[model samples]
Target: MLDFSFGAVAMGHLVACVFFLKFWSRTRDELFAVFAAAFALFALEQVLIAWAGLPKEEQTWFYLLRLLAFLLIIAAVLRKNRRWS
Candidate 1:
């Protein structure tokens, strides 16, 4: 079940990356750029989490990356809405 959850999160991050890239290409909006960066960072977090069996010590770093990614997503959403409104 843990493996499945990790796989699902990884896939979600990858999909979000693809959509962010598409948005960037289509609109060239800075918000999309932010999203793309955030998603890429999120993807890194997913990768680290998925492969965390390397060393138990690295789990903390993965969690930190996830937190940073979350902050980026929040920042991007706020910026996007502020621009639109």
Candidate 2:
């Protein structure tokens, strides 16, 4: 059951990546590029999570990819909102 859930999540991430990449291509926006990269990383992380087969207690390392993806999103938002003098 867990495998099925992981597969579904990975597929969702892949779809999101594709959409983001398409938007980036159309808009030439750094924010969309960052989003696409983040979603791609999320898809990779999901695969790694399934591949590792580690117990919940030992899954900390796998979470780092998620952290990096979130950080990329945060950085992109901040960059977009920064005021230009």
Candidate 3:
């Protein structure tokens, strides 16, 4: 059940990444490009988790990868917001 869920989540992330890429292609928006990259990292993390069989005990580096993805999102938002300036 857990393995199935991980696979589903990974696939979902990949789909999102593709969609973001399409959006970036149409609009040429750097935000969408960054989002696609972040989602790709998310997919990679999910695949690693599933393949490594460490659902509960992910290593520090994996968590860092997740952190980087989230940070990418936050950075994008901040960069886009005028109030942050």
Candidate 4:
């Protein structure tokens, strides 16, 4: 169901944020901050997506948020990889 996907993504993003924060604390690296920002956006995107009662026009912004958030996550990962190597 759509509800399930939204919930799952929200939860997953939360978990990822927590994990990244822990890693950040241990490593004291700035890369984690990038991930944190990305995950935070991801959480926002999911919240917007879940509000099914919203107008179609509003939902369009949510979709854009989701796309940008998704790209940020990927950019964070790539940046982290480069930092590590």
Question: All candidates' lDDT scores?
Answer: 0.78, 0.93, 0.88, 0.79
The segments of candidate 2 whose C-alpha lies over 4 angstroms from its true place after superposition are 83-85
Query: Higher lDDT: candidate 1 or 4?
Result: 4
Candidate 1 vs 3: which has more TM-score? 3
By TM-score, is 1 or 4 better? 1
> Model 1, 15-75: lDDT tens per residue?
8888988988998987777777777777787677767765667578677776887788788
Task: Name the lDDT value of residue 32 in candidate 4.
Answer: 85
Residue ranges of candidate 4 with Cα displaced over 4 Å: 55-58, 67-85
The number of the candidate with the highest TM-score is 2
> What lDDT is obtained when candidate 3 is compared to the true structure?
0.88
- The prediction achieving the highest lDDT against the true structure is 2
* Model 3 poorest ten-residue lDDT run: 54-63
Q: For candidate 1, what is the TM-score?
A: 0.69
Clashing pairs in 2: none
For model 1 the local lDDT of residue 19 reads 91
lDDT of 4 by residue, 1-85 (tens): 8767888898898888888889889988877876877787787788767866676677877777767877877887788788889
User: What does the lDDT read for residue 8 in candidate 2?
Assistant: 93
RMSD in Å for all candidates = 2.9, 1.3, 2.3, 3.2
Q: What CA RMSD would candidate 1 show?
A: 2.9
Model 4 error, position 63 (Å): 3.0
